[model samples]
Target chain A: MENHLKNLRAEKGWSQSDLAEQLDVSRQTVNSLERGKYDPSLPLAFKIARVFALPIEEIFVEEAEDKK
Target chain B: MSERIKSAGKRYRLEFGAAMTFYMVVLFGAKFLADGVEPGAWLTTLAIAPVVPIVFACIAFFRYYGSLDERERRLMSDAAALSLVIGIFTALTLGFLKSFGVFHFEWDMLWFGPFLIALWGIVRCALLLKR
Candidate 1:
C-alpha cells in the first residue's frame, strides 16, 4: 500500500515522532509507515485517518493503483 | 521503544544482564572451585543457580510484552508464530540428520532458543522489507 501520510504529516509540521505520539504508537511504527516498510491494520489505518482529519482513501491507496 | 514500553524494556534488559552475568560467573566459578569442593549434587544444583535470574527476566519479558499496543502485539505474534514454525522444522531436520549418522551435534535442546530467535529476526525483517 501507498500512503500520503508523509505529506500529511509534513503539512502539519509534525515529525514522525510527533505523529507517533498522536497515534499512541512507537516512532519506529511511524517511520515504517512513512517508509512503506510496514502496513497498518484497519484500526491503525482508521486512527491515522482520524489524526489527519481525512478520509482513509485520501491517506492510503492501493500500491498497484499508485503505480499507474 | 514507545513511551509505554521504555520502562519495561529497561527492566527486562537489567534482568537479562543480571541473568547473563550470573550464568557466566557461576559457570566459570564452579569450574575454578571444583578442585576444592567435595564432589556431590551441590555442583549440579550450583550449575542451575542462574535459572533464578532467568526466571526474573522471563517475568520482565511478560511485563514488556503486556505493555505493547495492539498493533505491535500483532506484529510480535506474527514473528513468534513464524519463529516457532521454522524452529520446529530446523529441529526436525537436525533430528533426522542425527538419525542418519550425518551429524552428531550434542546440543539437542540448546538449539531451539537460538533457532527461534534467528527465525524471528528473519521473519521480522522479511515482513518489514515486503511492505
Candidate 2:
C-alpha cells in the first residue's frame, strides 16, 4: 500500500509525533505507514481517514498490478 | 509514547516486578524446604513452586502485549515467532547431536524459557532500532 501520509502530514504542518498522537499510535507506526513498510488494519485505516478528514482511498492508494 | 501505552508499560513493569520478586522468594524458599523434606510428593510439589509466580508473570506479559498498537503487536508477534523458530531449531539440533553421541552434557530444560525470552528481546530491539 502506498499512502500520501507524508504529504498530508506536511500539508497539516504536523510532525510524525503529532500525527501519532492524533492516531493514538507510536511515531514508529506513523513512520512505517509513510514508508509503506507496514499496512494498517481496517480500524487503523479508518482512524487515519478520520484524522485527515479524507476518505481512506484518498490517503492510501492500492499498487497497480503492473507495478509489481 | 502515547499515554495509553505509557500507562500500560508502567502497569506491566509493576506486575512483572512483583511476580519476579515473588518468584525469587519462592525459589529460595523451595530450596530451603527441599533439604528438610523427604523424597515424596511434597518435594515434587516444592520443585515446581517457582512456576506459580512465573504464570503470573506470563499473564502480566500477555496483558501488556494486548495493550500494544497494531504495528507494535505485529512486530512483537513476529519477534516471538522468530524466537520460537530459532529455539526449536536449536533444541532439535542439540537433540540430534546428543542422540548421535556427538555431545555428552545434559541440556538443562530450564534454560529454554530464558533463552527464548532473551532471543525475542534481542530480535525486538533490533527490529525497533532498524526502524
Candidate 3:
C-alpha cells in the first residue's frame, strides 16, 4: 500500500521519531513504513490515519498489484 | 522517548550478564570441585547451566508481555526459528566431526555452542526489527 504518511508528517513538522513515539512504535518501524518497505497492520494504519485526522483511504492507497 | 529503548536495552544487558556469570560460576565451580571426580559430576553442572538462562529468559518474557507489540513478537519468532535452524546444523556438523575423530569432545562445547547460537539469534532478530 502506498501512503501519504511522509507528506502528512512533513506538513505537521513531525519527524519519523516523533510519529513513532506518538504511535508507540520504534522509529525504525516508522521509517520502514515511510519508505514503503513495510506495511502497517490495520490497527496501526488506523492509528496513523487518526494521528493525521485523515481518513484511511486518503492516507493509504491500494495499488493495482495489491488488488491482485 | 529514546530513554525507554535505552532502559530496555540496559535491562536486557543486565539479564544477559547475570546469566553468563551464573553459567561461568557453575561451570568452573563444578570443574574445580570435581577434581579427580567422576565425569557425571561435571556433566551435571554443564547440563544445568544452559537451562538456567532459558528459564530466566522465559520469566523475563512473561513479565514484559504487554511491552512487546505484534511486530516485536513476529521479529522474535523469526529470530528464534533462524537460531533453531543454525543450531541444528551446527549440532549435526559437530556430531559428524566428533564421530570421525576429527574434533575432540569437550564439556565446554555444550555450553558455548548454545550460548553463541542464542546470542546470534537475538542480534539477528533485533536487526530484522529495524528493517
The model with the greatest lDDT is: 2
Model 1 chain B: weakest 10-residue lDDT segment is B1-10
lDDT of 1 by residue, B3-97 (tens): 66666677768877877787677667767766566757977666666566567666766777787766567677898898888888877898899
- In model 1, how large is the Cα lDDT of residue A50? 94
For model 1 the TM-score comes to 0.71
lDDT of each: 0.78, 0.92, 0.73
Compare candidates 1 and 3 on TM-score and give the better one.
Answer: 1
Candidate 2 structure quality by residue, lDDT tens digits, B1-131: 57788789999999999999999999999999899798899999999999999999999999999998999999999899988999899999999999999978876999998999999999999888776
lDDT of 1 by residue, A1-68 (tens): 77899999999998887887788788878888887777898998999999999999999988778899
- Candidate 3 lDDT (Cα, 0 to 1): 0.73
TM-score of 3: 0.70
What's the DockQ for every one of the candidates? 0.33, 0.60, 0.38
What tier of docking accuracy does candidate 2 attain?
medium
Error of 2 at A24 (Å): 1.7
- Candidate 1: C-alpha lDDT: 0.78
Candidate 1 residue pairs in backbone clash: none
Model 3 ranges off by over 4 Å: A65-68, B1-3, B38-50, B61-66, B86-130
Docking class of 3: acceptable
